[model samples]
Target: MSITTYGLQHIKKETQHLSQEQLSELLLRLARYKKENKELLAYLLFEAHDEAAFIEKVKGEAGFMFSQLSALSYHAAKGMRKILRLLSKYTKFAGSKEVEIELLLSFCVNYLEYADRRTTYKPIRLILTRQVEKVRGLIGKLHEDLQFDYLESYNNLLDDAEKKLIWFKKNDYQL
Candidate 1:
């Protein structure tokens, strides 16, 4: 026999009459059991109000992670992947196209600076390319004014990446 599970709608209806204290207790219980629940609860309670500050805080985290990356190519690739995953998670929590674009731009800029040459590490290049495409898609969904602003930033990153690629090729550091 299969057991039926309560959907979120059902759960919401069941808890609709919960007092503030009851709600708080429920949240604490959920948070205690799962890391994602804790993060979502923290976002709803704290970071949901001030989006700009939340974006800045996440950007700071990405920068800190970047600063601590291993110099070895394999380790650095792993660190960059972790930073991207964290930034993506925070972007989901923010639920804002602007936050997503800003976080991506921050990530791409740092990535271009650190991982300039695709020949050095293909995975890093793949990560950078994927993020740039994501940024492009996101920019199109924003309002026209914000679209222009983000497109300019995205173009600049691409320009810099191209220049670096050319320079690296001329220097012949790697094939």
Candidate 2:
């Protein structure tokens, strides 16, 4: 990610709204991490903490406790945990009932891939793509640029992933 110079102050200045810079940084981080074959644990501690902090910030802003988050976030996270368990993976990560990048990625790569792309589907796909960096948007909501840049990258990744899914399907190739 190009978020080389971000911190709490930067976080406090941005918004949940979408912008270019935010998206670049988020997508960069994601692509680099994925290309490097790095697990979420491979990211810096501050980054993870920053992410969790943003989630907490959103929850705080919405005054929505973990128990009150959308069923999508809750159930999907649980489903991801089941996958992790089946994979025999072990980590000291947070509870599986809340938002986590692994769960979000799994949801994107697994379930969301099946939906046909169209006018009605963009928003949810956008939400899924943005979900990973939604923390950045949340932080950005509290920061300077006002609109969140992360959304741009998230949307692009979602779009790219969607396109690849379509192509692969047409070609009878498995993702």
Best by lDDT: 1
Measured against the true structure, the TM-scores of the candidates, in listed sequence, are 0.86, 0.24
Error of 2 at 171 (Å): 25
The TM-score, computed over Cα atoms with residue i paired to residue i, of candidate 2 is: 0.24
Error of 2 at 102 (Å): 1.2
Quantify all predictions' global Cα lDDT against the true fold: 0.80, 0.42
Residue 121 Cα positional deviation in candidate 2, in Å, after optimal superposition: 4.5
Off by over 4 Å in 1: 1-3, 116-118, 167-175
Model 2 worst lDDT run, 10 consecutive residues: 166-175
Tens digit per residue, CA lDDT, model 1, 13-78? 989999999998998998999898899889989989988888889988898888888877888889
